[model samples]
Target: RIAWLKNYAGIDYMVPDPQNPHARVINPVLLNITQGPPNVQPRPRQNLNILDHGQWRHLVVGVTALSHANKPSVTPVKVLSDKITKIYSDIRQFAKIA
Candidate 1:
């Protein structure tokens, strides 16, 4: 679940705009991880794991006869399987953030 990102994590970046010759080039020093932010609630260790990998979400749909035209002829079990497959495709689209 771990990956390297510019040496460390937490969305670090540096701008090298030469227009400002006197600008600071060094990284900022911060307090140790044990330090607390006075305003925000303390995050759980599970949150750090989320940073390592994107979150997974699942959506499920149950088949019903209301949407079907051949309710009497089509088996409810087969309808459910088709509905589940469509749900999976929807999930894939959602994962793409479209």
Candidate 2:
């Protein structure tokens, strides 16, 4: 599961919490529930034809197959904010070199 996330989502670290020795801290952007708009209903499983091949297949399959039941839950808003902050920081760093 950790390897799958690292390979497909570019998430290399799962921070360990000393306070909760059993918990693994993964970025919430990796969750299926955080991937789409809040107002829009998820496409039915029967309609996900795009997952059958190509890059989407790799990502979708890996994410869905991972065992998330034991992971801590995070609000979608928090996930969005974290993702935005990461992107902004990345862009700033890239701009410095280019």
**How many pairs collide in each candidate, listed in order?**
0, 0
Candidate lDDT values, in order: 0.38, 0.48
> Could you give candidate 2's per-residue lDDT for residues 1-98 as a string of tens digits?
56755653445456555579899776444444455555565664334333234644454444433423223375544544454454446455544442
Per-prediction TM-score: 0.29, 0.28
Model 2 segments beyond 4 Å from truth?
1-4, 7-72, 96-98
Question: What count of clashes does model 1 give?
Answer: 0
* Candidate 1 structure, TM-score to reference: 0.29
lDDT of 1: 0.38
Query: Model 1 off-target regions past 4 Å?
Result: 1-63, 96-98
Residues 9-68 of candidate 1: C-alpha lDDT, one tens digit per residue = 221233233567666342222212234554565664443222122332211221233223
